[model samples]
Target: MSYVFQFGPILDRWPLFLHGALLTIELAAISTFVGLAIAVVLAVSRSFGPRPVAWLIGAYVELIRNTPLLVQLYLVYFVLPKAGMRLDSNQAAALALSANLAAYATEIIRAGLEATPRGLVEAGLSLGLRKGRIIRHIILGPALRSVYPALGSQFVLQILGSSLVSAIAAEELTAVSNNIMMETFRNFEVFIVTGALYLAMVLAFRVFFAQTNRSLFRWAA
Candidate 1:
């Protein structure tokens, strides 16, 4: 009852919040796009590529999954500089997030591929289709469609996970919030608004994903 709340300082900084939020969205979108591309490749390779290649892909998936993302981010941002491949904070953040997302999505997609009936693949083969063609034409779409929901969920997690990128000073929503909190010294009010913004972003994306699922995969229903 004694704590008086003041939001004027936070509200006055709307433009900063907007900038930071847009950056957050950009980070998540880039990761989702890049990550999905990588996931599809890894999943297909692991499922149908040659044994040695598949084993390498499997090892990659397990390695990424077992490691903490913070470590991955550090390696990309900090360690790579020593190797003569330096990326700025945002570039590093995007790369790390994309790599992490790719691993989990790969597993989800693999499960979907497994659930697909083998007969369909056999049918494609009987038609003289190459195994690669069979995977591309007859297998990839259905396998991905079956797991779209899971992939979408992983993307949502990636958005939240992006908050962690602030550790490298990527200037995303959380990083911006921290800056504002330091200046305003209103940690309580600043975080409450920041949390609300995150919730709104997540909900908005969920709705978009739901509508997209309906339009894009309605045939699956």
Candidate 2:
């Protein structure tokens, strides 16, 4: 069958698509920040908490990591509502993505934490630094520096994965494109344009993080 390209019709709805893209970026930004905070705590707990606490955190990480994010999202969105704790689609998407991202980040940051040298930790102790102070000043920097690249790549991946939120009708970029395709009957063209938009967003995030790392990690210079 010959296919007709109707990109022009889809382009007419650019404003709706733009708004959806903005929502997606907002969701990603919130989730990334919240997830990173949770990850830092989990990572530190795994490294320094009591045995039982560490084991619990490890299990949580493994469970989340092994499961599919879509299943996780469904539990948060559909199942939670059935349990009388309801969340809107966007909020549920953000919560689900944040929890999923946290599991991965926990492992990433834990690896970074483990990479700290024993000698450097001892040096901090000899300088009369408390354990917390030693972890913050002596270990945190090198650990983050060692894993910043991985973290950056994960952040980009998270941005791309945000598209899945559309399954819940979150009206993100992909959701917007789907709507446009339905309205304009331009399925292929709309999707192609949306894919380009997603690519641009990912590239923008990469560049932003690259500059942020340069500014934040001057010691790495």
What CA root-mean-square deviation does each model show from the true structure?
Answer: 1.2, 1.7
For candidate 2, write residues 107-137 as lDDT tens digits.
9998999888899999889989999888888
Determine the backbone clash count of candidate 1.
0
Residue-wise C-alpha lDDT for candidate 1, range 1-221, written one tens digit per residue: 59999999998999998898889998999999899999999999998889999999999999999999999999999988778986899899999999999999999999998888989988988999998788888888899898988877787898899999999999699999999999999999998999999999999989888889889987778
Report clashes for each candidate as comma-separated counts.
0, 0
Cand. 1 Cα-lDDT: 0.91
Candidate 1 lDDT at 185 equals 97
> Which has the greatest TM-score?
1
lDDT of 2 at 22: 91
Candidate 1: stretches off by over 4 Å: none
Cα error, candidate 2, residue 125 (Å)? 2.5
Query: Where does candidate 2 stray beyond 4 Å?
Result: none
